[model samples]
Target: MTDLASFPELLAGYFEIPIDEPGAKAVSDPYGSVRVDVGVIRQEVRSPGYLVSGLVYDVSTGLVESVVAPTQVPTG
Candidate 1:
């Protein structure tokens, strides 16, 4: 497995964004959630929107356990 510290660089490369351009935005899970740094790399869109994807790293374990993608929600 790759080092958790390198996730930001990996994400930057995957998204074709500059590593030094503040590409990765840090996020967090709900309260009582596991300790992890959630880095979101939003999908670039022409208009304003919320579509995004990211990686989850376990802070205690120093490992990346999963990649997350946006899920569709039914609209009324």
Candidate 2:
């Protein structure tokens, strides 16, 4: 909730999720617990907005594979 803004790199990677098996999962990091899925993000993306932020996970084990944050984004 409050810490959702901590990881932007992993979230950005989801932007490249294959169009077929976009995954969904809950991750616990410095930002607390979050429910995320590239599929959902793809379905509901609002550009000109803040970059995404969260951790990625394995669809089967729910193990965090990586942390993602935009790190930096073009402001134009």
Which candidate comes out best when scored by TM-score? 2
- Residue 25 lDDT in model 2? 30
Residue-level lDDT of model 1, residues 1-76, one tens digit each, is 2433346666566546677632233212322122222222222233344444444667788987545555332222
The most accurate candidate by lDDT is: 2
Each prediction's TM-score versus the true structure: 0.24, 0.25
Give one digit per residue, the lDDT tens place, for model 2 in 11-74.
4355454333222233333223333444355346655655655565565787874454543323
Off by over 4 Å in 1: 1-5, 22-24, 27-76
Specify the poorest-scoring 10-residue window by lDDT in model 2: 22-31
RMSD from true fold, candidate 1? 8.9
Instruction: Provide the lDDT at 31 for model 2.
Output: 26
User: Cα lDDT for residue 34, model 2?
Assistant: 35
